[model samples]
Target chain A: MSKPVSKFYLGVDIGSLTTKVVMVDEESRIIARATGRTGFSGREVASRLAASLLIELQLSEKDVAATVATGYGRVTFPADREMSEITCQARGIYQLFNKAETVIDIGGQDSKVIKVLPGGKVSDFTMNDKCAAGTGRFLEVMAGALEVDVKELGGLAEEASDSCSISSICTVFAESEVISHIAAGRTKPDIVAGVCNSVAARVAALTARTGLAPDVVFTGGVARNKGVVNALAAQLGTRLLIPDEPEITAALGAALFARDIAPKNKPCV
Target chain B: MAEQRRYRPLASTRQLEKTMTRYYALTRYHRLWGRPLRRPLAWVTSGAPVELLLAFNIHPVYPENYGAICGTRKVSAKLCKVAEAAGYSQDLCSYARSHIGSIMRPDLAPMGGLPRPDLLVACNNICGTVLKWYEALARIFNVPLLVLDTPYLPGEVTGHAVGYVHEQLKEMAADLEKITGRRFDARGLEKRLLLSKETISLWREIREFCRAEPSPLNAPDLFIHMAPIVVLRGTKQSLKYYRQLRDEVKHRVDQGLGAVENEKIRLVWDNIAIWYRLFAFFKDFSQRGACFVTDTYSGGWAVELSPGDPLESLASTYTEIFLNRSLEFRARQMIDLIKDFNAHGFVMHSNRSCKPYSLVQEVIRRQVMRETGVPGLMVEADMADSRVFANEPVKNRVQAFIETLEA
Candidate 1:
């Protein structure tokens, strides 16, 4: 029998919007997780985040069995294992919720919908990276337009009974549409809710094409927005199972993948 | 009223015919006639004749265009025989093959062609493929070559960027004047700018017509729609042709017909056309009724000028296009297109030949999907150059993606 690895594993998700890091022991139990806004220096941000997490956990780099990097800036991070977000998320979601058939990750700058198969493999997926309409930036723009903070937009979305409709899917035009809606006497909460609905609708539209298998797990920064999550759930016609910390799914997936690879470092049974 | 009356057809059939002929001709090729200056022509020591050489006082020559001309004219096949003997692949960019082919028969002008260029300007903005492309031609023709180095703008166009590009345009103008031994005429330049804007306006109108409930044309067919830009940019014929095309599209939209007979899916095309497998790639979409309602090209032409400052706006517009901007800017553009066209999803060409365009595609694909909740697929292929196009792989991936979307 192979000796058990006393090693910790690290997973870093260096995304355009935010960089996420997660650490786990050999058994795949999450030890620590770090979420930080990524600016111009993604590598530096990811490295610092991982280093701090290691220190917080009182673990050394040598104790790490394997490291995996995933997300848009996955390759940018200097990690031992560079798996695509697809592989990382697939493994990560499978570990968290075994029943998750489709995984939708809406990041700060981009969004992805992965069709997960039986064994935690990505059967198919679709991504939209060309626009800022359904991204965090879109929310920020809408927030600024509404004269509210982005963090507050979600709660604001929950407050309204009668929501305003924003037809322009273009971020710039949507901002204008929001302003016009306000001018047309739509309540701020309703407009915010409409924006959330619009964003969820866009994602739902893309995911609908992929043929979502229910027990869908929604992860990513945008998933933190209760309004968006609910809106998405409503649109997909499925109850979304939000992980305890949805944002760390990619990093968690990366860490899980690190564990899967860690066993390879040991002798076969 | 007088202006309308003056332009009206006369009673005589001859007058009517001339009027109709002029109207149609102007509607087709009128953009070619407004030559701002009667420029002196320079003879190339060796190469095809420049199309605008006789018309413009400035010497006109494009190595790549000349290379394409050779291949289209059928002389490249003979030259490929020589290059093949010297161990060049037949599957390289057709322009490169044709240019190298031209070199083998230096004495012969390949039956009919332009004289060799006195000067060659190669810009790496469109694709890095052209840097080496023109290097081959520079070696072959032994001409003075100027390489315009455009740093890849990663996100948005700032004021500093507009200034930098404007400076570069000025430098290009200086180089042209020095090569032609002529003075730079602002008025002359203004006319060209006006013509270009007119052409762009017509193109914008045609593209805008595609936003109709049933868009008038599919994305692949846009390759044909875009002919005037490449063949006659900065020419009156291009302007006239665009007007004609715009008229045709307007008529079609008015009649309420889908651009393609049965457009199954409305898609936004990202990246440049895969020129090598252009027909086949487009056919794959057209056969499926997946109409490309809009594209990055139309977005590029979506430039409008503030009144009374056309030249400045042209300079600004050219520099600020999504092509000239950062990946973030391009992402925004893509999002804008998908939303504007009411596109169901996007098919981003992860063009192998154009790295600048394709490198951030995966990221953009992810971001666009995330933010807009729009579905996107990246089809790996090359822009223009055929050698890098992996047909089967691209076809399979596209087919799978389409099926996934349809599903």
Candidate 2:
């Protein structure tokens, strides 16, 4: 059904809220990519996604020379090696934009600011593990509070005439702030814009903890939201270089690592 | 998973367990013989001057150490909840919360809660929380609470600061004399101070053994083995335990054995051990060939006794602990440990309970990294509370930190 493949690499990133899988050729070309909601079990979802993804390319698991897993569920997923999302993000960003000196990744439950050394090594990183204030989960809660779809938040925010102040960085507290804003007759566009600006402000503080260096790359699910992208850019006073597919960059990076480790396993030609 | 995970524990843990068990057992049943022996048990903070308690023949018990026991036993959440339900805010120190919860509900605490105290000594050297915590204890027990106000030293330990603490010591000694019906003798404290000095020196020597290429001991070893040092610091039992520990550590260093199976990377640890997940947490590092060669926490007990007579030295020693020092001193301490231990990196636990230790850690981490040119990572968690430690998230951070170090 498809061209015969000699060697291919697989990468799986089973994050908290989503599962992504990518297949790459010997030249690191992305052969196929798939993503899903990662519902109950990331491991099962990852395995199923990989199975269906392989069939789409008419490739079997045997064609995969190596596998590397990265993310919250990476340890449970069967792979040749497990890497941290930070390392994989840096790798993916470096490969796409070689000049990226900093990476700000806002995932489902946590946000991180990574300082990348030459060649994509993570020289320093600071993550907000204490709370979910500056993450996608925070946005999800705010959207639910406003009775708006999370995807529509960006479009709605772009129409705001005035930005209502969401004073609290706490998800629960900020939800109340949004309710008060709604009760005070604030517009939906204004409230949604305030929510995005709040996330940007929280993330901006994290960058201060780890000094922001330029040619910055923003990755992860939240990077898909253009509202946050614009707000974060304005907050940090720098332009962000976003990949074509932000959510799958970590999976691509893991696949790149799988490529690097492929030669040690049988011939990766 | 049903089978419990076993670690390569130090050879001296048997002695450590025996010493600690006996100490707890004795403290547990102190009500049986304490009054008859005229040795009133005094509940004290971790940084309290215990040698003076010994001089007065007063048995001292540590609630902070018992909080650690509750944490390691995995009952801190149950205990802490009891305290929180009783109006103690969840924001309070987990140690204080769990300990106070034990007071409200001893059935949930280890050793059925520390033996009831006849007096309480609250020292502010370690943290300001102890003052309020001990005052509450005094209220609950209706015992005479002795407060030792150690001035915060933004720089070196000043004569004025030491004098201020020395006056509180005199007042404390007088209070002890009235309670124990005995005269306070500066000369009588000599033997206790000597034993404490010798035990601390032995601990220092044992820590120095970790300077070896493949560190003979990891931070967990130091944490587990330092129990006697905390509870039985100024006694023959503690002295005996450290002697065994020192020799075993020396033997490992001589034979080129490492606590971590493959010690490829060496790290210096900051802050208290995550007691509830101690083994499970450190295993993440050790399995990755990262051995915590040294740490700032257990070494808190190994501080040198200041040069002075017993009282003056006690004033300075207790006042100058790492937790009491300035940010510059703390950053310098980490930098020195990194250099002296030849560590690849350092990790600071942004402990939710320890405000003093965790507050300035970011600044200190930045300073340490700048001075040493090595990366430092901070993990957010509570030392004793399980509710705050998100397992998957913590694992993610540790894995990333280990990868950075490996690269």
Q: Judge candidate 2 against the unseen true structure and give its global Cα lDDT, from 0 to 1.
A: 0.91
Q: Which pairs of residues clash in candidate 2, taking residues 3 or more apart in a chain or in different chains?
A: none
Query: CA lDDT of A142 in candidate 1?
Result: 93
Q: Each candidate's lDDT (Cα)? A: 0.68, 0.91
Model number with the top DockQ? 2
Best candidate, lDDT-wise? Answer: 2
Quote the chain B TM-score of every prediction: 0.74, 0.98
For model 2, report DockQ: 0.82
Fraction of the true interface contacts (Cα pairs closer than 8 Å across chains) found in each model: 0.00, 0.86
Q: Quantify how close model 1 is to the true structure by its C-alpha RMSD in Å.
A: 21.5
Docking category of candidate 1: incorrect
Q: Residue A9 lDDT in model 1?
A: 85
